[model samples]
Target chain A: MSKKRIIAVSMVLAMLLTGCGSTAATANGTEEAKVEQVGQDTTSAAEEKSSDGEVITLTWLNHYAEAGKQAWVQSVKEQFEAKYDNVVLNIETVDADSHKTILQTKLASDDAPTIFDLSSNADLQVYNEAGYLADLSDFECLANVDAGLLKEGQVDGKQVGIPIELSGYGIFYNVDMFNEYGLEEPTTLSELKNVCETLKANGITPFATPFAEAWAFSCYPRVLYDAVCWNNDGAFWEKLADRSLKFADCEDFKKQMQTVWDFHEYWGEDAFGTSWDSAQQIMANGEAAMIAHGSWAVDGITSYNPDINLGVFPMPVSEDPSECRMIKEPGQQLVLFNYQDERIMEAARNLYNLIYSQDCMRVYAEEAHQMPSVPGDYNILPALAEIVNYPAELSFSEAGLKRNDPEHEDVLFETMMNAYTGSTFDVNELVDALDTAFDNIKK
Target chain B: MRKIRISSLLYILLMLLAICIFIMPVALAVLTSFKSKPELAKSILSLPATWNLDNYKGAVERSDFLNSLKNTVAVVAPSVVIIVLCSSMSGYTVARHSRDSRALRLLDKVYLASLMIPFQILMIPVYKIYKSLHLLNTLHGMIFMLVGTSIAYSSFLYVGFVKGIPHEIEESAYMDGCSEFRCFWLITFPLLKAISATVAALHTMWLWNDFNIAVILLQKENVRTITIKQFYFFGKYTADYGMAFAAAILSMIPVVACFMFMQKYIVNGIVVGAVKS
Candidate 1:
């Protein structure tokens, strides 16, 4: 009796599963039919271009917060749409770190957006090599943009991406706190050390650093490496780029690593565990005297405490005090993908032009509080203007594209991070690890 | 009498210590939510010097708290119900029926084997299947996926429980000229109430707080569930932890309330299912 009952139940389950499979098969058939219809429509539209409406939709992928006060994106979108009635804009916002991962996945799947943001020149190079982005050299908008900024977006001889904004990373100090402690902004490595000692004597943590995420410490070594190793020489990057020079062989690179290792004494005891948010809070609460980050923090600080007085200074150099080469890069770039529709391409160009226009630059500067790539005298907040005018390098130094190959570049910093945080590894071991990793990538 | 009182006091102290260990983080989140961004930076663990409800208000407004609450309920409720019904029926059949056919035995083995396969490997394929069906960003589609994945394991538990139920009870119902469906629904299902309740509670918690599928399938703002909404509140460059904590607190309320109400059934279901052959 039990055997017969089991047979009956098994039959029921089999029938249910079969039903599900057929339903899924029908769904696939419908999807295929839709794809065919879309292909046919595209062909017919091409033949009768004059008769069909010329409106085009450009899909933009960016990493911007969509929550309250999205004035930055909204202003740009509105200006573009108002100028070109036939253009439709679709923007997809994602987290900055996740954007690269998602963009790579989308590219592999062949669902790439028409325009997307690229973080580094090496990233621009990778996609350009893949034939995934459009060449912007022919575009008339390139005339007004700086040649140096354009060079950051070029792969080989072709311009593949457009610079949107520029930023400088260095130490931003609380001027009021510095005044209270009777200390001036440090101009050299030794002076900076003395100031740190003075701050520590006054029961204050001198520098706020968060090693929990590990990436925050990357900025320290990058600034130091640029000051010591490159010193505004283009040959340094050229050699590093083609793999002729190893970062470990450079004496300045070692000194830079040692400088970052010395920061452990000035940082919080549990700095390795403190997140960026907590570290920022520590500085905001006046527990720490200085924050070493990019100018992006200007808005974040003002938004948190409107009354707090802030000052910006270049990262101290080891050799020539006057040669303060601040590490600067375009905040991000917008790259267009290949689309057959001429109208879509035209609309994208129009939108691109509107964003770079002087009028839009003022709004972008005020709202986003970021340095506009285009040269214009716009009224910016006093504190922001001060940082904008701070003596800084506007071109890619040793730390820009040359140090940004995803496969080879990441190991040097990762090893440095481990070494700096009291990991018992000799300098030779660190150098060997970096050389081995870079050599493997060359293969 | 004094010695007995002293022992009771010691037991109470131990319990209090455990509660504190568990409750401190949650208490800090709540307190931080009431602080200004600057104040929060000063003392993340300390009580607020000034009470502020702005973070909670901001979190709710930014996350679209009401709409997400509705979407979560719509997906989780139907999924919980469908899984309970399907698993109970399948479990009842497997438990009561002892079949000899090779196909029948193979099907039983497949059901048990599927429980071992991790869901991560299946996520992409499952998403492609749903996309083809035009069900990628819909609440119904999400609920359907959850129910399908859940039925296998829930049915396994039901199968064991149903076997322990006496065969005579269902046999008597069958002898009364009742249909197999009616006999199972009227006689067998009532006896498996404790098991059903357990499945419902477990599935309710799982489906309600699920973040993985919600992120993969739903892209539209109107259809996003609570977990996805919480993620949207914090972008890459900026994250308001106070608001994130508020959203976390809000998402837990429904599940916690359900567990509170159904504590007895959940306990009984686990105890009986464990002891059964």
Candidate 2:
């Protein structure tokens, strides 16, 4: 071979070897770096303070990027900084859609946020099991929180997080349209049916389903699931969790599935194609009398028409009005990562306490338009009057079920979707599917 | 003459249809971004009553567009340069040695195989690897993954282009006592410019529009890319879609600017990478 060929071949050989070498180096480098991080953490654990008066920065990751919530978080940051001259609060927010994955990744990494938002119920349970949470059982802020509300925030009988706000799921009706049609808020299944019939007769859509999105479509079924299954002494979820019960065994589930069918019939012609925001528009514009949604959607509707006279009411799925109860869940909560530094832990707790104080809760209630977890009186939005007055029940949220079986929520959501839309959906078939899926999940 | 005119007319019509199909969604977003919330609720497809810039202002303020733009450029520029350098060298080797040795042939085969492995399959493993390496939340970490994920296809292109070059040029250079490194750089590299340009343009497009790698690797507010910024912006303003649309449109500007800047090289690169090989 010519000299050029030899030169070219040697260059190729060297370049190819470098590629292979770098990958092995990357893997070995990874293991070594992790060991180094552990060493650093150990050495730094005892040195929590930054000399005498140097500012110690605490990083907080949250999902409250919404307009009003952002202000509330900013207020907390300002107050926390004001109280502790030696500390600075650094805030970062990721959107809710990707928050869980991003937060989980950060928690497993060395750079976990000092404070973060813990999704209520099962999400909290997962992190608690991993020892990623700082036990806030002795945190003073929990003292002022209503006992029942505080109890809901607990996992393994330990208070792991502080509820930022509480909200419930129900029907948001156009009050002007209801009054124009001389309709009273329905208190029973027959009454709801009659109301729908009357609205239909008046050339108005009784319900705007927002079935284009599966989660929104699942809202009514979820609320109905609470009323029917939850009224059976609240033991249904525990039985499901322990594998002693199956969805097929619940007679009330089938009855509620029929209400799912009724919701489908009442859904407007464009329901399958209309989005959640558009459905709110339909309700706000008085084209639809009601939308089955949660408290968060009140702002969504009011944004479209600021003067939209909206009111909330429980979906009367059962014949007996006494069985009706709105499904409530604590919205967002402040939770701390298990940090080794005592000073950092103290700073995070101080911030948490400041954020949930009665003064701050009042601002949160007024500004966020979300109900306070603490029982002291605050200005409640008129739209929430019906939900606040109605009998409320804490249902087995899918997130709670998901902690036991990761696939349970997916299987349930799919089943609900199929039940709502599938022409040949049988309750028995649905129940069998649910049972089979639950067993598979357990396996 | 009539037949040629008619054929030309048909081509123009076809191009127009393609353009319309591609541009309709972008145009809709632009139109919707100009509308108020009430107007959007009234009709999504209708022209705005007032052509307002409130959505754009809100999106710019909320998404922290300037900081994200700086971060995106910081990540993309260095990463693209690294990808081009590594892939060109590797591609040169694979193309020349594939016929001579099984090891080089196997190396080339691996590059081809890497192309088949989807990014999603590697997402978790990569995250774990990144975490262990202390590479999480850093622009350097993002740059590393972007270059790693892109090198295989780009090297594949380089290898093909390198193969077609006459070995006589490098052979003669070696006869004059030029070292392998010197000969490859002075002679072979200059010859590989067309393909190198192609590789740079192609990977720039890939890295510029990427969300998954950046989303997984970069978590800090100071290091966020435009795609993740827009994702968070839309999440924040889901109830206010006019503002979300404005943010979406703003995010598209950088990618479009990149394509426009690389347009000449891109068209040539696509042709050369596709047909010349």
Candidate 3:
């Protein structure tokens, strides 16, 4: 009787599973088929003007899923659809890690996103070498952007991407602390050191340099590079890769690095166990006067103390105020794959025109809470409002791409931290270690 | 008798300590979930300054929590049942016939060998094949890949458990004029319940939290599972730890409930299998 009951139960369960599986499978198949038909429709849609009264869907795969960005994208989508009734701009946002994973296949396939950016500036070389990036040098929509600003996203002197927004890395200082100490924002290295001395005298740490985390500390090298080698393009990186240059031999690179000795003296001693969050805590809670971080640090600081009066400035690397520059990189680049269908490519270009339009640029700037990338009268970050204007004469220094020696980046960062955390700092030793590590990488 | 009681009490206390050690992070997550951003920054370990539903509201609106939940159930439920049923049949046949049939023996060896190869090695190749089959961006396709990738290891589990079971039970059923299908399902399968429950529970948890293959295959918004949705959730919203934790707890409730319920059967199965062997 027990055996009969077990058989009966098993049969019923099997029958139920089969029924559920078929219903779900059929529904999934219908979804898949419908999506395929849309792909075919987009391919067959009208080219350029969308003159045949068919909708051309431009699929854009991006990784900027921030709430502000989503709002801005939606605004652009509505404006774009209103302007061009025949063209539909479809956008999908994935995370950076997964975007990079999907792009491994998507970039090479013919069915790639109509508009998307490469994961890194270094990838411009790889994707360009593969002929996967569309050269938009002749794009009339991109004509308003300064040639120099657009050059950061280029490879082999062909414009491959338009810089969307800027991520400025600099000194995030406590405004209230500076005011209480009667310290004006420092614009040169000597003044910065004096400010550090005043903060130290007042029993506050000056810099939360985060030596415990190599990636957080890694941005310090860019600070030195920004001071000495602003706008060298990818020349410095390619030289380092091809045995043409060594860090010790690069004079400008070595010139600004001596300031790190002061950094080590001020903050490196107790920073061995500090993380980015702890460093932010130190700044927000008034334990530290400033942090060697970027514009993105504001959110973390505000989360700690909503009323924390904080400001950003270009970390002065030399005595001359005129030469001071923010260490800068693109927050994201707007790009299209060359492998996509031509009609879809044209539709994406039209959408780009609207995205870079003055109205849309203002929206993008306000959402990013940063200065406008292109030349425009727009709202700027209040923290950055004092010392800078749109397209300030003081420029930005883009990091040299480590094309072949990618892992050597961590080696470089770890070496910097390792040098700074020592009892005494030596600039030459740090630079020598960097050169040795770079040389050791198999080209 | 007093010494014995004392030792037993100590053992139970140690087990309770072990449970607390494991549960600390979860307790912290629940605490942090109720916090606002300021409260989170003030202290991650302490209670929220003011309990509110705002973080949960933001997580729901942003993550499409319910739709992803529906999709997760759609993918995991059918996949687990199919894996259990098919692997059990294959395991039983191979366990019974491998010595007599060279093909069956080779098939068993191949399944065992395939377990050693990592998914990273197969990821790109599977992706390319899926693309050619127009299986990209489809939940059913993802389901197919999940079932196919999981079968080899699942079958290997069943094969070991079946070999340990007495064959005379099935042999007697066949001799009593019962069909081979009835003999296995009615007589042998009921006896194999402990191991079957273990496999079902293990695969259910795994398929719930699967990210890699799901990330690659389920690229469309309408088809995304909860894990993939959370990947995008934490991408740029990580600054607001209160909201991040809220989103985490919301997504975790179902899977944690699942694990808690399945955990008892899993432990019992393991112990019963050990005793029988």
Best by DockQ: 1
Query: What is candidate 1's CA lDDT for residue A42?
Result: 30
Which lDDT tens digits does candidate 2 get at residues B39-87? Answer: 8888888999989899999888877888888888898889888988898
lDDT of 1 at A56: 62
Off by over 4 Å in 1: A1-56, A66-69, A81-87, A96-101, A104-110, A143-146, A230-243, A361-363, A378-387, A392-400, A423-429, A436-443, B1-4, B98-101, B108-120, B274-276
Please, what are the lDDT tens digits per residue for candidate 1 over residues B1-277?
9999999999999999999999998888788778777777767777888777888898898778999999999999999999999989887777666475566567678788988977654654565576557786799999888998889889888877887788888889888988999999999899999989999998899898887677656755688888877765565545677788888888889998998878899988877776775
lDDT of 1 by residue, A1-443 (tens): 99999998999999778545321112111121112111122322112222457556666777766342256676877878787766656665655545554455344333456788877787676566556667777877777665557777888878788887777777878889999989998878888998999999999999878777756766666666665566655566557656798867877766666677666688876877877777677777788888777676666665556667778777776745775656666667778875556666677777778777777777777766778777679776565566557554532332234554554456666767776667444666666666676667677
* TM-score of chain A, all candidates: 0.81, 0.85, 0.79
Over B224-256, each residue of candidate 3 has an lDDT whose tens digit, in order, gives: 888877754443423556667788888778877
- Which numbered prediction scores highest in TM-score against the true structure? 3
What's the best-to-worst order under DockQ? 1, 2, 3
Q: Write the per-residue lDDT of candidate 2 for residues A184-251, one digit (tens) a residue.
A: 98889899999999999989999988888877876778778776676554666667766798777788
lDDT of each: 0.71, 0.74, 0.72
Candidate 3 C-alpha lDDT tens digits along A1-443: 99989998999999788544421101111121111212332342123344566677777787766676667878988998899878777777787666765665453233556777753566666556555568888777777664445766778878787877666678888999999999988888889989989999999898886657776776666766754664454566667766588888877777767776765667834787887777777777788988877676775676578698888788787888877776666656777766346666667778878877778878776775555456577775566554245245565645333333356667767777778776886778878998888888744
**Model 2, runs deviating above 4 Å:** A1-55, A241-243, A246-249, A389-406, B1-11, B98-107, B113-141, B171-187, B236-239, B274-277
| lDDT for position A282 in model 3 | 76
TM-score for all models, in order of appearance:
0.85, 0.86, 0.86
